[model samples]
Each structure stands twice: as C-alpha cells, then as structure tokens.
Target: MGEFNLPVKQGYGENQKTSCIKCVLWGKVAEAYAPNIKKGDLLVVSGEFYVEEWVSDSGKRLQPTIIVNQIQLAKKSGDKQGQAAPTQPKATEPPVDFDNDLNIPF
Candidate 1:
C-alpha cells in the first residue's frame, strides 16, 4: 500500500532564470504523492515560501520571489510502483529549536 499522507522534508526548487513557464519545480516531491512519482518532470507548484523583499534605488519595492521550501506535485499519474522503496527516517540532527519553544521575551 502507498503511504500518501506523510511528512515532507525541506527541499529547494531547481529552476533557472529566463524561462517562459516558471512552474517547473525540481526537488523532492512532498511525501504525500512521492510514492508514485516519475523520475523527471515539470510541475506547477504552490506552497509557503520566504523571499527577500528589497527596494530599488528609486525607492520602489523590487520583485520578491516565492522561494518554495516545502512543496508537492499538485497531481500525479503513473504506474502504481508496488515496488516503491521504503522511506527511512530522516538521517540528520534535530531542528534548531528542538529543545524549547523559547517564546519568552528576554
């Protein structure tokens, strides 16, 4: 059985400048639909992002990019890879704020 509802890991969207269709995100598709993903393909993605908001010399706000952090393919279609590899636990250290909430105002 394919595990669709799974936690997603942080990844970067691989794309270059000067492209007509700016919707080809190249990264690890959120685990939800990764079970049945093709090797390589472009997709229209939407997700929470953080971008640099700056101002030009004319005091005009420059274009801010929507940096995709956690994303998933909106749709999927392909063979049901019954042989989908078993995803293992994240092999890395804990997050930066793993210890405490630290919401107190010092």
Candidate 2:
C-alpha cells in the first residue's frame, strides 16, 4: 500500500538524476509491516519486480512495483558486530531479617 524511492548510481564519479519508481506490497505482508516501517529507515527487501500499467483521469501511467516477501531493518553504522545488545536490569527482592527471631525448643 506504500512506496519508497532509492537512489541509483549511474557511473563512477558521475551523479545523475534518477526517476522515482514505485513499489507495492500486498496481503498480510503489507498489513503486518506497513505500520512498523518509517520514512528514512534503511531496509533490506527480497521480492519480485514488475511494471504496472494503469489509466486514470489524468492519463495512462506506468509504475514499477516490487512484491515484497521478506523485509528486514538494516543495522545502524555505529552498531558493533558479534556483541549482544544491552537489556534492562531486573528488580531485586527485599532483604529478610533472621537474627531478630527467637525460637528455642530443646
């Protein structure tokens, strides 16, 4: 239901403007991930690409779409590899007093 644009490199040391291509994801795949994703977030997607033709009140247009099957968020640059991420510390139990108790039955 949504689309994203990625810049492409035409040549070495040369920058050229590229057209924006639209990609679409469907079914439960889209519903499950659409809300979680945000703009400017890096992602790695595996899917099939195709061209879709449609006619609207304006005119006929062609849009490139990718049917995403798997999507994953890319790790940030500063994140270290082979290291476990930190977690919140658990609460400690209250200490018990045993010395104050006096029970002698011999």
The prediction achieving the highest lDDT against the true structure is: 2
Tens digits of per-residue lDDT for model 2 on 1-106? 4556644435445565566555555544555566666776556665767788989999998877666555666655566753343321221321112223222121
> Model 1, range 63-89, lDDT digits (tens) per residue?
333322233333234437543333422
Local error of candidate 1 at residue 59 (angstroms): 2.6
What lDDT score belongs to each candidate, Candidate 1 first? 0.32, 0.54
**Which residue segments of model 2 deviate by more than 4 Å?**
1-10, 55-60, 78-106
Model 1 clash pairs are none
- In candidate 2 the C-alpha lDDT for residue 93 amounts to 22
